[model samples]
Target: MSLSETQPDAAGARRIARPVPLRESVYSAILDMIVSRNLQPGQHLVESELALMLGVSRQPVREALQWLKNDGWVDLRPGLGAYVHTPTVEEADQLLAVRRLLETESARLAAQHATEEGVEHLRELCRQGFAALEAEDVATMVALNAELHATVMRLSRNDVLVELASQVDRRVRWYYTPVARHRGAQSWTEHSALIDAIAAGDGDRAGEVMHAHTEHTRLSYLEQQNLEKSGADAGSPARPITGRRP
Candidate 1:
């Protein structure tokens, strides 16, 4: 039977429909693996192995890899096959720069538009994030952190800004995941200040606080990368800041 086409049943009497296209299923599985860091940066993505792991055939896996390549999640080497995209410093910088611009505007607008209830929602997310941090539950903390930022963006009441933020949102989470544990207490502390600025309806202050807050995360990631590289160059084991692979 052709992998991308439907096959007849043994009796040749019934048609079975798939819930989703095989290629899309493969694509989602692979992307989830990438986002979860199970497929680490620069890791080889072998189609046969991926197919086997995902319980699909190689044809779907191949198609999914092509899609992933187009989406900047995979790199198809001319001769060496596909690998997860290892983001360059330039790429990271450019993305984060754009993120800062969008989020700064969002924060400023959020301050102008935030209702008391909206501010309280942010506060609740902040509290949950801090609690997760204290418990050393990095996953929950990261999720809560995302929720807090998303709430602020929503409170901005600008659909255009929200849409733009959504575009880079997943990639931002991918970049943020590795360092979430490291940011810990300090991140939530920044959120607290941002919440205060928003609550006070200080657009300028809110923007300034968010700008600084994001820069902190960007710098933290860069610093950690530098340390890892230094360790490698010095012939020492490169210990991750998070102490465990995400």
Candidate 2:
């Protein structure tokens, strides 16, 4: 029998259903691997192995690796394939500094320009974030956390500011994914304060709160690092932060 004639229509239908778009699928797969710590910083990405694991062609994997390189999540090395990028303490500090400046300005603008509808949306986002936290849905909480920040940036209505904030948001997420569980209720409490400030339309207060929040994140990261180092010195397992799957 011919191949077509041997196969039932339903069987063929299942096999011929379109696959996910190559670029997007590969991007998401690699991102998830990175977030989950399956691809640790400085770990090499072997194209053939990744292609086999992802069940796709090397072309798509290569394209995704290039995109990740541009995002500062991977480093492309000549003859050595791509390696995951690690943020140094210095780099983290610099990023947090920039984030504080940009986000605080964004919050100030959001307070001034956010319409009633925008404020309501922000409130809903905060509510959902807290609910997710209460339920111990770390993934949902992380997603909502990004949504809340993005919504505020949109309300700001400054294209340049929004773009900067978007970049910072990605880095911030990478930082948070590892530490979200440890942060626990404190994170949501800060979000509540931020929401209250924004809802009150107090631009100066909103900016101040945002600035403090960013600084608080920086401090927490620093403390975590210190704790890890101390633990190592004391001969305990160096509980390094572990990221979530994307």
Model 1 stretches astray by more than 4 angstroms:
1-19, 237-246
Q: Number of the top candidate by TM-score?
A: 1
CA lDDT, candidate 2, residue 89: 78
Tens-place lDDT per residue, model 2, 77-97, is: 887779989777788888878
TM-score, one value per model: 0.86, 0.79
Task: Tally clashes: model 1.
Answer: 0
In model 2, which residue pairs have backbone atoms overlapping below 3 Å? none
List residue ranges in candidate 2 displaced over 4 A. 1-25, 35-38, 76-81, 232-240, 243-246
lDDT of 1 by residue, 52-76 (tens): 8999889999999999999999999
lDDT scores of the candidates, listed in order: 0.87, 0.81
Number of clashes recorded per candidate: 0, 0
